[model samples]
Target: MSIHFTVSGLTRNLFHSLGLDNQRAPRPLNPEQSLLLECYLAGQIPESAWNDYVFETPELARHVNARRSQH
Candidate 1:
């Protein structure tokens, strides 16, 4: 049987090939969280919405903060 790779599996392989193994593993986001993140990045959401999203999705909040620090 052939092996099927998910998006994340492909991402890991790409990272490894690029010698970026030390990177933190990606966190899986639910549908709602993903949409919220997209909106936040696009500046389509308000601060109040972001605050509530952070409270509800603490893990994603940490991930977002880490990305911010990198930039």
Candidate 2:
């Protein structure tokens, strides 16, 4: 047996099962990360949560920092 991924880079079966696409899937954020980033980008996350949140998901900090440096 063989498996094939679609143009979006995910297996067609997995895409259908997850109901998420590259565009719809959060950019720079892995699917495993919680939706906290969605809220963070929207500025909804409280200051109190920033420390713990970034500590648990440091990649988010790195991604944002890199984008800041590029511009």
Candidate 3:
């Protein structure tokens, strides 16, 4: 999903190749991935570990990173 979103310069090129509009969202990407993708695309995360976290062990990553309820 993220791959579909953050791939290197492939977005516009492929869109053009397939005769897709630059104005429209690409069909290859899902709605969920679009958020992180936009952030990544806009260079918000300078020291990004998003790729490793998601690809390596998403469940463990989420478990460790999940917010605990404060009492």
Q: Which candidate number has the best TM-score?
A: 1
Regions of model 2 farther than 4 Å from truth: 1-28, 32-34, 69-71
What lDDT does the true structure give each of the candidates? Answer: 0.74, 0.60, 0.47
Query: How far off is residue 24 in model 3, in Å?
Result: 20
Q: How high is the lDDT of residue 42 in model 2?
A: 66
TM-score of 3: 0.30
Model 1: which residue pairs collide? none
Range of the 10 consecutive residues with the lowest summed lDDT in candidate 3? 62-71
Instruction: List TM-scores for all candidates, in order.
Output: 0.51, 0.43, 0.30
Candidate 1 residue lDDT tens string, 1-71: 89877999998889867747535655888888778787887799888988888777766665676567778
Q: Considering TM-score, where higher is better, how would the candidates rank from best to worst?
A: 1, 2, 3
Who wins the lDDT comparison? 1
lDDT of 2 by residue, 1-71 (tens): 99866676556657656643222322477654537666765688886787687778656665555545657
Comparison by TM-score, 1 against 2, better one: 1
Ordered from best to worst lDDT, the candidate numbers read 1, 2, 3
lDDT over C-alpha atoms for residue 26 of model 3: 28
**CA displacement after TM-score superposition, residue 68 of candidate 2 (Å):** 3.9
Residue pairs clashing in model 2 are none
Better of 2 and 3 by lDDT: 2
- Worst 10-residue lDDT window for candidate 1 reads 17-26
Error of 1 at 62 (Å): 1.6
The stretch of ten residues in a row with the least summed lDDT in candidate 2 is 18-27
